[model samples]
Target chain A: MIIIEILRYLFGYIEFRAFGGFPDRFVNLCTKEGIPLWNIKNAGGRITACTTIKGYLAVRGPARKSGMRCMALRKRGLIFFLKRNKKRVGILAGAAVSVALIFILSQFVWSVSVVGNTTLEDEYILSEFEKYGIKVGARISSVDLKEAAQTAVTENEKLSWAAVNRKGSVLVIEVREITVQPQMYDNSKPTNVVASEDGLILSLDILHGTAEIQPGSAVTAGDLLISGVIRHRDGSESVVHADGHVKALVKKKETFSAEDFSFYKLSYENKRKIIFFFGIKIPLGKSVPETNFSEHKSFLESGEMQLPIGIITQYGAVYSEEKTNPELSFQDKAALLGGAMYAKKLLDYSEIKTSSVTEKTDEFGKHYEFYAECEQEIGRLQEIYVEKTNDIA
Target chain B: MPKRKKQQNKRKNTPVTPFNPETKLEMLGNRELIIDGCKGIVDYGENYIKLNTGTVMTGVCGDGLLIKSFDNEIAVISGEITEISFVS
Candidate 1:
């Protein structure tokens, strides 16, 4: 318990706190070293030195004979006098600063990093590992690096295997991502092209085999869009498989404007953060005014192998709200609406091709409308019409 | 001259032990001495006797004693001597 208190006392110095009393031995040694009498203060107000060089002479009478003044000073606690003799605050601060600096220097990882992975993503792996104490600036000795790294690898599905190693202060993690191979299908078997969804036929191009449907034909689900049944002129049916690219003119209609009264506006906010140890929080500064600010926050945790040491870098969005004013021009509102729609589209898909753009204006607001056609080759699922098992049977 | 003659007679009567050039012996009392050759304890309490040339001692006795010599040179033991004889 005393040891803990001592540590706390020492740490308090780091926080710029001064505890009363001089360290007994250091003061005594300093006194013997002839470190000016005025420079010394005992635990009590003994006043070992006075500017009147003959200050020691004042005790020559009855007080000196009995040594009463010295005794009284000792009784008053000589250590406290020494404590007052000098600037206790500066000493405490210096000691604490030195200790803190040494401790931080000792605790810091000589080297930090991530390992043990391919495919799951290096950044993803590193992010998860940051929570484990194996990150940059974290004290290496105080953390169970191996345990944290291993635990992280086991918990994440994408990382099939992981191991962490520490060499000095450097943390190394070796990992293996989950492996997957697409299921191979026998392409030699004849198959027919079937409609994946019910839609009016847009366009079809049969590279090999025969087309069963024409343009503008309304087709239902499971209907054959292309047939692999090839015919022989000799009155015999030879079913040949079909393989080709099929394009369709599918119509989709969607509203492209947000309600003016309910639209969310993102206002950039700058928050100043003060970092100390593992804790981080914004202590001051504002990115946006409170009236216009909307709070948004997200947290992701990550760490090394088996250890739980990691960091959580929180994401926050502060948005501002402005009152709808008549000053906002129609053209400006149209452009903003277009930008919002485009942003929404970009968020939903990786790529978009704008086929056409249209504008609409109403009493509420102005909006830009668009009729864009996008072609995305989703998957390699071939339709089956004739079964190869039937041919063998 | 008389002291020299007496010392020579004493040497003729005493067996000469030659020490290897590398031989050395340490004694107590924090003192070190090198000898041409001397029999019996090379070092006594607080005394050190060492041989750098070629010399030898037959017996010795004391605290903290050691004997060492180069190959085929000499040896100094620590103990009291029961017999002493001069060898040609």
Candidate 2:
């Protein structure tokens, strides 16, 4: 039935009203004559039916023989529709052209994008793509992406790997740069190894300089521990950069005091509010009745695409200080303060070897003295300037 | 007397043939009727439609009867079909 309706719509059909005859005889004549007619109805001596244009034309003879008068009521289907809208021919033409244009444009690259490139610039990679004739507006069928990527990698020494891929209308080039390691120090320059801090020397492993201090030797800060000047057998000395590791035992001391009295404890209560507009904040209502409060403002962004208008949320946290008495005994307070000072002093050392803490109480307050012995690197690089001697001297 | 008996026996053994020649009538509920091998339309009306199928005349009684299609020796009549009967 759907196929028949589609055929009717495509081939075109006409609906007509028949009068002045026996409608049954008219239909019989039409059927017997092989003039296809359907949707036939009779009302008050008037008959109506629909048929294809050819069927309607062929029915004229049968209609006459049946003593029926025929008058077309309406025309339908594609042929009649095109004839009715003949004035808007340009619209159909434009639609056809746009379809063709889209098909043609999809076959070519519209834009070029570069990804995974850090040191290499987009323009540089695009320029390499241009050399391979794989830039924007290039035909996708004509471009060999594998060969282009290989060529790009071969041409640039800094690029370790490169790949060219076409994603719909975009030509993408992904590249990775070659990583270079740092160079070692120059040996021809003169440099000295000095003590980084005041410590007792533990050991020394000189790689390119003469050791001026031995184990158990005490050195102060800025004291030279190794000399970069090497005296040769020809009675002349040459300068070189010194490179070695020096380990020493350093002592650190820190003092802390605790008061045996009540202290103030601050409690933070937070409230949030949102504001719209740039840099202008209007408080909707008071969050808390506390007089002391700090507000942190942050803008809410929808996505990666930045828009000028945003929602600013102000997070206000009220800090109220309440007086509270200490809950620990005097000995416990002294031990806690001493342990805290010990940890603070240990932060400056690489490794702690031994530590001792002593607590002293006076009329002022309880005092904690913490001492720590640590092992650490004590070498600091210091450049030595050589003086040019005159030959006459 | 034996020949008459044989003729009666032959008549009893033979199968009866249908009156109409392969006319296919299909009814979809009470709303539509499709008739194949249709000869022509005998009468058309909103209340009833009579169709000729070479060997018999079929009358369809309905309200708002419409011949939806008539082609290739087939007729599709649609509407609220109440009854269908053979007039001849």
Candidate 3:
């Protein structure tokens, strides 16, 4: 119904008042003529109604026969509006130029974005994309998306899968990282199980060799816990691959000095924006080198079509990260423990049985001491490096 | 829906009427009245509106009575209707 009304509005219509004479004769004649009319009211011997433009033109003969006159009260609809504004050439030309400009701008790339990347940085992905013609202000027709995706996956070993999809004038590059599986140890050769760190043996499960260290016995790094040599009751001896899970309590200690902590006051003196258009960077004022920056971008967009022309604002914040002794807080203890865990491989080993920490902050320096006693699998496979000999001598 | 039992089932009690295209007068709770197959307008006024329905002359008495539209033998009258009478 709304669509029909719109069509009627586009075709144009008029409201008119028919007065002086037999109005009923005019209405009956108009109905017989099949001229559509609606919202008709008769007051003071005058009939007011709305009719289509075609109906109004055909209403004269009926009005003449009824001795009544219809004078158009108001004219409405699209055609009438256009006729009213036909002399405004500048406005019409401007509208035409704007539509054409939008059409032309939508043919170029407005921006580039990276997705599906957890570890790879957006700048790194975009830099890689630039090599394949996937850059802003570049012609969309010039970029070979399929070949670019293929080359990206081939060049970057970290990415297992990659795809380039176009959304209006914006280019989206999605990537999937390769998941590397842990390597398995070969057991065909003769080997011995040795301790990886200083630990007191709590439990041992020897797979193919005899347990050399007894439970509750303390052993340091490089101490053999399982021997590959297996002696039979018949007085014959043969060597086999020695594998085992040797759980032991290992103590580790790590410390952070005042030299490891530093503080920096933000220097906004080096802050300035460097605008980049397409692949070219334009400096609006004096430029300074910066270690990091935050970029904000905007482009003209109509619906999903983004215009290639846009502005990029880059802020240069100077953070020297220079070493200066400032008092260390509990956050430093976390850094100390993190360093200890990385060095001692505590998390990969096993759960901690006991832990303790001590910290000191003074004019001399800040110090953090971290200690942990954790039960870990201390058995490490060590190849038997002895030469094979048939002579007992 | 399930079939009713013999004792519970009963024949339709209302008579079925076929389609009738003669002049028909319908009143919308006395607020409006629609007269189909109207021949011509007899008198048009704020208090009274009369129409020729071939077989009878129908007069609608109301306040601020109006002929909303009249075309192709259908007259749609709307207002605060006080009475409706037909004279053969």
Candidate 4:
């Protein structure tokens, strides 16, 4: 029904009234001739109706036969519009050129983005893609997106998978980086498991080596816990690689200080804005002297598509610095203590079993000392040095 | 000829007669009447509208009666339709 209405609007329709004769006979004659009409109304001895352009022209025969007449009340549609404005050449040319400009502009990429990458920098990934003809202002129809993604993956060994997708005028490059794990020491080498810290050995499990100390033995930081020597029944000694987990009780300490706190007063300030379009930067005002500045960036976006137009705002401020005591409450001081002992860094490789804290204050600021007893894996591989001597058996 | 057969023969012989696959009248809450399979507009007036529904004449009595369209044998009449009656 909407399409019919639109067709009627596009092809042009006429609204006219028939009077002074039988209007019903005129309408029936129109239907008999296979002409379509709508919005029929009867008022004050006249029947008004709407019909298409062709129907209105052919309706003269039916009107004369029924002894009625039609006068086109209004003419509307695209054809009529063009006829009315055909003399204004400049307006028509300008409209045509604007449409053409939008078409050509949409055919080129406006922005490029990189997503789904960690460790690998966004600029580095973008540069890699730029080498493969994926960049701003490149013709989208001519660029091979799949080939670019494949070559990018092949060229960068760090990337396991990569994909390139175009969203309107914005080019999106998605990448997955390879994760490499640290390798352990070679197992064929003859080595011993030595203690990395001073502790009482809580438990010990040895693999490919002989036990040097029992669970209840106390060992220093450099003492060996697993020995690589093996004596056979024939009384001959052989050396093997040492591997073991030795859990021991270890003590750690951390300190936090507030002596570095300083306050600053603004001496002078300036705000600068730079307008950018399609990767071209144009400063809107004079550049200020370089100082400590907070920067903000915003881009013009249409829905989810980012246009290549943006603005950079810089609030440059000069300040006079002065040393001052930190304004903190008792709870704030205690919360800061949680980070003071960088000693909490031990939780990465050890579990804290017990802890104690000591606090001290000076004219500069307050200080905290954190002492903790932790269960830690103390055994680490150490190469054994031995002489190759010729012995007669 | 049988009555049904004679009617079917008349339909096949007339090409300009409106197709009568089915006659349906949908009344929208006494406000509008949409009629399908109408042969033509028999008579049109402000208080009353008459349509040939192929099998019988369908009359819609109302105030401010207007025919929205009479194309493809479908007539959509909208007004404060008070009553609808069939006149053979």
- Find the candidate with the highest lDDT and give its number: 4
Candidate lDDT (C-alpha), each? 0.47, 0.79, 0.80, 0.82
2 or 3, which is superior by lDDT? 3
lDDT of 3 by residue, A24-129 (tens): 7887788888888766777778888888999999999999999999999989898897788889988778878999988987888887778899988988988887
Instruction: Order the candidates by lDDT, highest first.
Output: 4, 3, 2, 1
A1-393 per-residue lDDT for model 1 (tens digits): 468445433332111111122222222222233321221222131223221112233322323332334222221223343466567777777867999987766556544455555556666777787777556556677778668867877777777776777775456777787777678856676778777655566567776677878877777667776777788789777666676665554433444553443345676544333333332344344333444333332322334322223333323556566644546666665556556666666424233444555567788565556554544321123655654454554
Q: Which 10-residue window of candidate 3 chain A scores lowest in summed lDDT?
A: A269-278
Candidate 1 is graded, for docking, as: incorrect
Per-candidate DockQ vs. reference: 0.02, 0.48, 0.23, 0.46
Candidates' TM-scores?
0.41, 0.40, 0.50, 0.55
Q: What is the lDDT of residue B16 in candidate 3?
A: 38
Model 2 segments more than 4 A misplaced: A98-393, B1-18
User: Could you list the CA RMSD of all candidates, in the order they appear?
Assistant: 19.8, 19.9, 11.0, 9.7
Scored by DockQ, the top model is 2
TM-score for chain A, candidates 1 onward in order: 0.47, 0.39, 0.56, 0.56
lDDT for each residue of candidate 1 in B1-81, tens digit (9 for 90 to 100): 699999999999987555444445444333222223332222222223322233443233233332321113223333322
Provide the lowest-lDDT 10-residue window in model 1 chain A.
Answer: A13-22
Candidate 2: tens digits of C-alpha lDDT, residues A1-393: 799899899989999999988888888778778888888887877889998899888988888888999999999998898788778988768867999988987887666678898877877778777898876567789989999889878987888998987777667788898898779767776899999999999989998888999989999999899889888999998888987989899988776665522234446655656464332345665565344544443444445322223444444444544332356666676566655554455356678898776778788766767687889889988989888788984
